[model samples]
Target: MNDVLFRTGGHAARITLNRPRALNSLTHDMVLRIDAKLTEWEHDPAVGTVVITGEGERGLCAGGDIRAIHDDARDGDGRASAAFWRDEYRLNARIAHYPKPYVAVMDGIVMGGGVGVSAHGSVRVVTERSAIAMPETGIGFVPDVGGTHLLARAPGELGTRLALTGARIGAADAILCGLADHYVPSAALGDFVADLAERPVREALARHVRQAPPGVLAGRREWIDSCFAADTVEDIVQRLLDHGGPEAREAAETLLTRSPTAVKVTLAAVRRARGLGALERVLDQEYRVSCACLGSPDLVEGIRAQVVDKDRAPRWSPATLGEVADADVERFFTPLGDRELGLAGDGPLTAPGTAGPGAGR
Candidate 1:
């Protein structure tokens, strides 16, 4: 019920996400419903365009309902969890290639699955209060929902830095990082969206946009690149510690406290995604790794400590990034064997994180 809202106005089809209580966090049912609606609109002649937005003022979508995945795994339902992710990934791909003008009114907190749903659109609008991030590593997961594709395109090691640290970026920083296309004031979203409902083309919407200040991350390029360039998280940590500044030292301590295996594997996944020719391939590789992490102790422990238990401290399987080995990392990427992420139609494989076997453990 609190999933999707569909309405037709003028020549446009509007899809409003309705789960504001949880920041419109996506569930498996929501994912399938969105896919169905998009498919319906794609073939409908009266619908000349589509708009995707969320309810409430707090945010767009936070991400997927990981609580369900956690529950499924606890019940020996890893395959079921993987199936949901596969469908979700397919929906993400559909948004990316939709033929019409797909406009995303990204307001408050947009992240993870939210990024995938809206970032691939023909038009992406951000606002002053917009807080965007891909913080999967912090939760013992890799950035999925085609997030790796966008992260791969980010300037320098900025993607890796964001992925590993779960750092929140403002509208300015988001625009600078290529995550947002246009910036309109947060106060103007309601009026702009209303106006947009009447105007169906790209150019008409551009007139409503007020020029925004350049992104905040523009000046921090040198520092971010230099700090994140290190190959290993430990190396980056050392660099941060050596910098003798509050920012660098604070970042280093933050990384040290995160799941060590998560940081290490996330770095490798980010680097690998950069080399892939397409998003599908990267997602495929991610699926294999994610399946391997099904039995991983860290996935459950991390979720319990952070989401279920609300405890700040997580007891990681490998307590430090330095403790994760190349073999331990390689296991995640190993082929799914017979347990492939197959779907009914044209769908993309999606892994929970960019990790190898034992990642969950």
Candidate 2:
């Protein structure tokens, strides 16, 4: 079957991620196809809105196909991985700025690449089954796909906590953290999409939205803000350790398990993303970091343990935050010289007028 299914009917354009058995993990070809379709439908007068979702009962998308990246890294060739990231990041930028309303039905697992596809849309929908996260740190890489842009904009230091821990959040928490916009039950999603095909997007969505449950992050915002507001990962860990609460201790332990380099880099990325003026700028920074990590051992090792071997025990280089030098962390943020991602455009996929969503957060 096609990895992705795209169709246009009535007043809506629809795209479904079709790889259900793999949780609809995005492939490089899939990203390019999505960009093409969005570009084609952007100015179609009959298409008032675009709707994206995944096939099957499992979820929307788990993430990018990490095994592909792992294999490329193992081969000591970074071309494929690098090309995938460059294109994926550009697709993300396109979605952020698309002039017509873009709707993402985040019905299930929305993490990593999935977040890139959904979270930036103008209308982001979630269901009771939604489990949203940017769990890249756990895989020995900082969150990309403009993850830092959304996480950085989250209320308080919740973004920092989420970035470092790679923790999963429910639908309400997804809304609270600004990663999602509406909460519609799983049962109502079909009817909502049907209405979207025949009626105005805002009206269709408004009619289906329901009250989300109390968010877990909302109640802990004060503590999350205090503990994660530190300047470095080391400082944040110390604060979490000293806080002497179960949540704080758990957060600290989770950080300990992730790549020390990734933890430090993620802290810096989220902090810097907060000051960025545009999503493209944030994506540019992420591309630099991603390319740097492609040459590092930790990323491959992390994927081996978590996905390949299922060991869940990765031996990260520079094993502790203290062992990671400031210069080592700085290397990930440096310019890519000739290989930088270039996303300038005046096409249908490009955002109209100002910088698209998540700009100036």
Writing each residue's lDDT as its tens digit, candidate 2 over 1-361 gives 9999999888889999999999999999999999999878875778878899999998999999999999999885889999999999998988888777888999988889999999988889999999999998888999999999999988899888999999999999998889998899999999999999998876897789999977788888877899999888888899999999899999999999999999998988998999985788888899999999998889999999999999998999978889999899899999977788855323344434744564321
**In lDDT terms, which candidate is top?**
2
| True-vs-predicted CA distance for residue 65, candidate 2, Å | 0.8
lDDT of 1 at 9: 82
Candidate 1, lDDT over the whole model: 0.76
Index of the highest-TM-score prediction: 2
lDDT of each: 0.76, 0.89
Minimal lDDT window, size 10, model 2: 343-352
Cα lDDT of model 1 by residue, 122-179, tens digit: 6788888888998877777777776777777789877778888888988877776777
C-alpha lDDT of residue 123 in model 1:
76
Q: What lDDT does candidate 2 reach at residue 193?
A: 94
